[model samples]
Target: MADDSIRGISRRKFIAASGTAGALALAGCTQQNTGGGGGGDDNGSGNGSGGGSLSGEVIITGSSTVFPVSNEFAELFMDEHPDVNVTVDSTGSGGGFENNFCPGDSDINGASRPITDEEVENCESNDVTPVEFQVASDALTVAVNNEADWVDSMTFDELSQIWRDDGAQMWSDVRDDWPDEELELFGPASTSGTYDWFNENVIGEDYQHTAEHEPTEEDNLIVQGIQDSQYAMGYFGYAYYSENEDSVKAVEIREEEGDDPVAPSLDAASEGTYPLARPLFIYASEAAAEREEVAAFLEFYIENSGNDTVAEIGYVPAGDDVIEENMETLEEISG
Candidate 1:
């Protein structure tokens, strides 16, 4: 279990601050929407041209890990500019690029991992140039059932043994003194960037992840599955775990066998002590940026990427330097 001090932040405050009371209405729903309207008083907060009310649709797809951040931003942005309709879909990073982003169907795509070469080529083939922005930091979290108190930390090797194909079946198989019960595994599907990072970083490319486990794009499903069985284990972005920390126990991670384990938290991730800490990103379509609404929305997103509200959402906020660089990139791409 993670320290209560590290995992106990309230997401309710973030919802109230963003003025999106309905943010938690759906637990595992794929799509989220901010209602659309036409012509409202301009607040000059959205960085729109002429300080007039901005009206247009912005579609964001990808990254269940980064979904909370983008979804929150969309709600806040739409609150300021009621005329703009914003919809966010958690299609997984790879799925978003292959299906919506590369196809030029979405204006922006959030990602937990950097865009791949193949995805870049696919986007270029369709004449869509991707402009990347670092939005936040995530501590990819591995968790087990709250009642599974026999273990608290796992080394990379133990994690690989448990997740790799044809690997450990029982908790005792990984360690001599542990229980002999079968290990029920739940995790993100292969399409997810979270899965990709875990596969490459934890599971290693030499072996494939076990296909025998339950896989889903919804992080809530993973949490639910782990909660139902004492032997069940899973991994996901820290936000979901933070939101439901009482329902699961996070496993501290050790980079090697002898090193001290580090718990996942905004502070650890920001300080680079968490082994699984990774940068979160949102890629904007250059052509889409030409649209006044899209450009304004992107500008707003970059400017607010480092706001304290992000930490309330259970991820490390971007730094001032990163936000400044993102603003510069947005200008270069959108101007």
Candidate 2:
């Protein structure tokens, strides 16, 4: 994928200007570009602290919601260890686990939600033990077209009434004073963690999510669909909504009718005030973590999970305590 990292800067420039020092600090390794590719001194440190240049490939796939963070980190990590090739793909979380990750094709998988028991069983069938790491937090954002100013906040019941199958066909169906225009829905497909979370939390178990809406793994497509119509509404990760705030309006969410509506934001998510706030993660394959480059890249990722760049990319960065716990987990899994 083209480097759509922060500020539209080239990957080389981003690395030269800021990533090098940050990466070095995170990995605690000095990069020595030997004229020729040579295996680093494998001091049996398993944690990637060996001396010399690290070389190899690390493949990451999963959650479109967590893709931005993983993709950015991969670029930065690759720049620090030029001989290491890191690739991140935005396969929906379930799709990744079922196809690439559980099948042992990817070293790591990013996920917006925790893995299911079925997924764990599948991974075990392939002998891939998945190690979970919380990398960040996201406020799942429900957005509507910028021009649709009839409503700004919605209660969980109202949200359910809109998303649940055969529940609401028009805006007026949810509330009396709202517009009578037909609701144009857009959202993530069944393979997406966002879809699962939304269904379980907002739509509830009694009803099914309407299939009348457009569904895709690409969040940008949801944004585009919302942008195209005045009555369009959809939900996706907060990062996508933040990046396209001008084109769409996020709906404030109230847990119940009497509760105040909470707007989706990094602060709201971090404070646990946002109704849709959820943790984002990356699962490392235990077998792959033994590889020097994969372990090194994961170390860098965990160390920088709380960095400013995470918030800059429009999500709540992991706190110091979370990072500490994650590092311990990384060490254990890699060891």
Candidate 3:
């Protein structure tokens, strides 16, 4: 089902930037035959009309970080195939995959991080095989308040100290000479793939954030929260930070002492020097991809979103090799 969790100005800004108008329509969809017109009538007739008009609805749900790119793609795709209705929702990547995607509730799932084994097992239990596609790359950004003058760079050990169990409660606790002001921490909800990645990479996998930390699925909230607090620190996809650059400053990170701290940037993320840089993905159920409408949408999605649209959305586009591999994967499973 298409979800209605996003709202407000942030949602409005997101939609406007993604180039869609009106609120999303979230109803259970029924397949429509495209009639005897255009391309391969895996449905009926084959009449060429260039892009070939197609019909039917495709449901896309998952990571908020991936939402902008997907929404833009959906808008463009629907423009070309006006009869084809596509719905996109920004349920956190983990929640979408764990609850919606594994049960085969959505045709395509966007993820800010790779799918987990547990999610794969759940899909298998439900008799669904998902084909994976790499659509973009993102730097998991660690950001701080623009006024947090005491901060400059942080080592992984310092980050772990601040986020791990019974984590450091004040800036001074993280370092001997830092300010003693209380450190307000914000982060993604437990259902976010960004949350999973940060915990696994920064905090210990089995460990959890301190009870005092605030979490939400909305990255805009994290941006606002950090901006409002002088001693605050939070993290989200680089897109959020980039979009709100005036309110927040990205923290340079170092794996250890003696290493040069690197900030998140498109170049650093692309070259793999940014420690938190990772690939973004989309997963499609084998059953869904077999449908002509879903297949066409998926092909169109990668062809468009994998490059320029990705950069426009404030993330790195997939490399040429990555794009080719995803195309190969789509052909292999959907064919």
Candidate 2 local lDDT, 1-335, one digit each (tens) = 11223322333553343223121121212222210112222211122344439998888888988887887777766556778878777778988899899999999988989999999999999999999999889999999998888889999899999999999999999989999889999998888888888998899999998898998987878989999999999999987887778788999999998999999977788889899999999999999998878888888787666665576666777776887788788778777
What does candidate 1's lDDT look like per residue over 164-250, in tens digits? 999999999999999999999999988899888888889998988889799988788898999999999999998888777888999
Q: Any residue pairs clashing in model 3, and if so which?
A: none
- How do the predictions measure up, each by TM-score? 0.86, 0.86, 0.86
* Root-mean-square deviation of candidate 3: 8.1
User: Candidates ranked by lDDT, best first?
Assistant: 1, 2, 3
Which portions of model 2 show Cα errors greater than 4 Å?
1-52
The true-versus-predicted C-alpha distance at residue 98 of model 3, in Å, is 2.0
Best by lDDT: 1
- Each model's lDDT: 0.79, 0.79, 0.75
Residue 300 of model 3, lDDT score: 67
